[model samples]
Target: MTDLLDPVSPDRAESFLTDHFQGVLVRPGDRSYDEVRAVWNGMHDRKPELIARCTGAADVSVALRYAVAAGRAVTVRGGGHNVAGTAVSDGSVMIDLSLMNRVDVDAGALTARAQGGCLLRDVDSATLAHGLACPAGVVSHTGLGGLALGGGYGWLARKWGLTCDHIVAAEVVLADGSIVEATEDDHAELLWGLRGSGGNLGVVTRFTLRLRPVGPVHHRTGVFPLADAAAALALYREFAERQGPDLHAVATLKIAGQQDWIPERLRGTPALFLTATWFGESAEGPEHTAPLFATAAPDAVLTRLLSFAELQALGDHGEPHGNRYYTKSCYLTDLTEGPVGQLLDATREIASPLSAIDFEYLRGAIGDVPDEDSAFPRRDAPYICTVSAQWTDPAEDAGHRAWSRRGVERLAEWHFGGAYVNYLQDEQPGKVAEVYGSARYARLAALKRRYDPENVLSGNQNISPAAP
Candidate 1:
């Protein structure tokens, strides 16, 4: 193995990756630099020293070697959808994986191998063609690399579990430029770390995810006036407890938007939205969704039956690229009166109409995996509260970021578990350890020491190799 921290001259960094790399190299002044470096969150405007658009795992290994030898901060870019904008660091060598997007599904085995650069839409479209699906994040455009490596939640989460759970195997490039295929029989611990610990351990080049049969599903949305939210919540609590494994439900509070169902006068008003999906059979969907439409005195209501792939794309409209985004989230032991009320109240002070707060009920298949089964923690947490800030003006950046933080801070009393890594934007010192607790963080830290001892992959939701 080569030394991970050997310092080569800065002048040779571009040449190093190009010498043996089978990918295109993008420079700062290159015509495509601006476009290639752009991430989903408009908040990040980083200019990397070099961009290696890797075509395969071989290119990933070489990119890491160049970053290591050149002593540059190395960041990896998949779909570039992370809210934290960790993909492009200042003066770093970006291992760009956007060109490696290719999904190969084995119809016989019911498994799909997606490259690091694949977005959720890439995998969803591919698997659905074979009449199979992989449970993943709600946004179809979300990067498979980040979502699978962190923890994925979606309409299918209730029946199939998180996207990370389906990742049976992966090709990872270590800090020292060594490639390893991680599966049950080889580097099993590394695979565990990849399951939920973020990409802190290594650069995952490809993921083999197990697939299940999925098809057209049911979806319903009931919008209630903010004043009547308390009553809606009470009904939702009862309705949620009665849900089966095929039912996935979520409650969102946001400013009402212009839609046919929503009266023009109520368009700008704050309202509570109840949405549900039944992933079983299209014929069986309405029965599961009836209660969602039963809420008394809803301001507006709409229901639809669409394919699982289509419902996944539904959220894409609300979360478009080029919006400045920041998020703060925490896992709740349960969604009780206190936390729910507080979370709802926090939304009233939104800095942007695009901002929204979501309360997701966790049930069913997610708990099927033991806490020790993978690096993902808080499997027992019953709810996750996400306060997201989305706006365009950079002048109000501090205020928006602070609002998101304060929203989560107010729930500190009810935040019984560490946050969901996928929804996190920032955490104070010692918080990363809190994400896994002492035992699991220690295990992950030890593994980090073995694979990325120099902490070359540090930043964002960082896991220090040093003993926790």
Candidate 2:
């Protein structure tokens, strides 16, 4: 990685920016820089000398060329939702993509064109109008660029695969300032590297995503009372094993104050909120999965068939743009007893009032994809676990972070030692290699060397060439 600690001074930075770009160029003293530098997480306090709000790919290329020529570090900012605050840096050229929020849907081809800056909800809202949808992040405000590049997962994942799986092509600005379109037929190797590779390759300006016809579907949600955290976890482990592609479900042990839907008994206790969505008829899904839920008598049942749009909206309640949140996620091949016990035991000790332990079932369409076909190699993974700790104060940040880390440590003994990069926050850089696995990590690093040899886009879950 380049030395980003000492960027060019503000005068030179503004002068270089003004000479090449016609869009807004903000500096430290500018009133807009304060707001522009503020990312999704209020915890970050970076002071980039310049922030260039690019108007299009041409402007992006210009910025990239300038950063390299001047030997300056550059950080790309989409929705800026990365919990690690990778979108901004202390002394770097912040390429703000917020101005590139545009969505174009091709109804005939069943695809959507999303600029790098658009959020999940932006694409969903546009595609749903045409009775179509694409796999994206669960949070509505997450940037399409960062999510897709890092292999996004959501409710539609089990049915349609991950966001990277739906990508048809992407327009990327390479290290030396050239623009290229990467797809299966053209720049195929780069396309393969782009998926699940984070932003180590290049700055993706736009993406052509595959879309599926998602009509009205059955949405069954239940909040089970948690008299026994161990029993609830065991039941969830069993239920996830039998779930099919049509059924997308997650079990979250959340704090009482987060939602009113939680059962009174489980309100302030360690409980499970199992939400399932089936794309087909409500009756069929319920009948197929009824035995699983029966394992533990649920205190509240909020199951019913609703439109696919409504189910997407249900998760919208959790805002993606703000609120101090720390998360750790991992993929597992099975819910072994030892790991399951450790998970339940860890959840019982959460000190934060806004923390939660979540289990997202991974099977069906997601599991059907070949490991080497795209950058995502976790097809064999049956489950993805996440510990999300959210709060509203800086003083409470350390406590929540420690709570999440402890959960990860407790579950580490039982896991396969792999994780989901998109859910990683404030963890070691080595976690990047752990998430992608050694063999695949080497391939990703080589690809990173080919496309971003200078490490121009090193702000993300970084990948560099292997040592000689």
Evaluated with TM-score, which candidate comes out highest? 1
TM-score of each: 0.96, 0.92
TM-score of 1: 0.96
List candidate 2 stretches off by more than 4 Å. Answer: 1-16, 258-265, 282-285, 466-468
lDDT of 2 at 21: 81
- The alpha-carbon RMSD values of the candidates against the true structure, listed in the order shown, are 2.1, 4.0
Error of 2 at 319 (Å): 3.9
lDDT per residue for candidate 1 within 339-454, as digits (tens), equals: 87887789788868999999878968998998877999988888888888999999999999999999988998888778888777656788878888999999999999999999
lDDT of 1: 0.87
Over 4 Å off in model 1, which ranges?
1-14
Among all windows of 10 consecutive residues in model 2, the one with the lowest summed lDDT is 1-10
Residue pairs in clash, model 2:
none
Candidate 1: worst 10 consecutive residues by lDDT?
Answer: 1-10
lDDT digits (tens) for residues 1-468 of candidate 2: 222223444446445555668678888899788988988876777998678898888788777766765667899998898888888999888989998988999999998889988878788889999989997776677788888888888888887888998889999888766789998899998999888888778888899999998877666566665555557667767777777777777777765544565555566666667666777665677776565567776766776677766776666566445578788877665676787776767777877666788876687787777888777766777777888788888898888888888887777655656677766666676877777778888888888778877677888778776521
